[model samples]
Target: MPVELKTPPSDDWVPSMDDLPFHRLGGEEEVKALANAFYDAMDADEPALARLHELDAQGRVNAGTRERFGLFLIGWLGGPQHYMERHGHPRLRMRHGHLPVDTGMRDAWLRCMRKALDARGISGGLRRFLDERFANVADFLRNTEG
Candidate 1:
């Protein structure tokens, strides 16, 4: 199960987006869990986005892609440098260069991620922060205009 998020107390103690997200997310395990949930949501709700990904024999997210993404998210959310340590700098656009990622694809990807974040009950400041960040990255990934 994904970790449950609770609102911080009245006293202001918001960690920087760099630190808070990973810590609030309960580290790698929760991130991995979110990754799994994210893909599961994609497979079930976003057929177009799911089709863009390579799936396994059972039509689930391929193990390698999931794990790599889990690691990527860790580094992205300020958890660890696992993805960079293992795969070096993440040339995200180049890595996804083969795919024709347009605005529609970007929006679909964001929609699936939004579903995953909501499904995990992620809310409050953490959720808002992530929604903004993910939106930016998703938009940036668009390789074609329109």
Candidate 2:
């Protein structure tokens, strides 16, 4: 697709995610817990997927890496730009370029996030929105054949 500019709608029109208030509803603390639970789910339920991560001596995702991603999620969900302030642009696909993100990896990653979302009681409209967004990112990350 090509870039196209158009007149903006009236001020009464609300931006999509802005209207959802996902981060506000989850809060920073809640998002952190969700991030940790996501990694925990990767550890417990998707060992093969977990192999793509850097684990700590305790056999869990590296603490700093986990924290960095948590920071990324916070900003990603319309919160403060902590991750960008400290680490610069996410460049998600570029960052994952070295990983052969095949269909299985993409699905596994989404599965972990979905489980994490479920664990946190994210449902209804918010859940649907988040799931679709996450799935899009996951699919976009794919770099290899099945």
Candidate 3:
């Protein structure tokens, strides 16, 4: 679900997944762990999805891919803007446009993410919120019909 702002402006308004999650989700380190876990799970369990990414000599997603994603997640969770500073806007769909994302790929990606979140012990409302957000983005990135 894209962020919704119901606003004339609440006294303490913040973007969804903004500042609150950054702090509540244990800041930079935990977020980076989540990114790492995501790629690791993809590497282990989703060969088709993993092959779509740049791989290393060991056949895992390359370090650069991991680093960039870590940076992206940091900013996405509102910890820092390093990803934006280094890469400009996320432009997620545009960046992913070259990939032939379809239902299968999208589902594979979500499974990896779910594994990552579960491994991290992410639960409760936070887990639900993240699940919805991830699902929305994954679906949005789909470029072809099944």
In terms of TM-score, the best-performing candidate is 1
Ten contiguous residues minimizing lDDT sum, candidate 3: 9-18
RMSD to truth, every model: 5.7, 9.7, 8.4
Clashing pairs in 1: none
Candidate 3: residue 68 Cα off by (Å) = 0.6
* Candidate 2 accuracy as lDDT: 0.83
Order by lDDT, highest first = 3, 1, 2
lDDT of 1 at 138: 87
Per-candidate clashes, comma-separated: 0, 0, 0
Candidate 1, residues 87-141, lDDT tens digits: the string is: 9999999998898888888888888898889888888777887889999998888
Q: What TM-score does model 1 achieve against the real structure?
A: 0.87
Error of 1 at 37 (Å): 1.0
What is the model-wide C-alpha lDDT for candidate 3? 0.87
Residue-wise C-alpha lDDT for candidate 2, range 1-146, written one tens digit per residue: 99898974343433265553335446677888888989999999999888788999988888887899888998888887899999999999999999999998999999999999999887766677678889999999999999
Q: List the residue pairs that clash in candidate 3.
A: none
Regions of candidate 3 where Cα sits further than 4 Å from its true position:
1-19
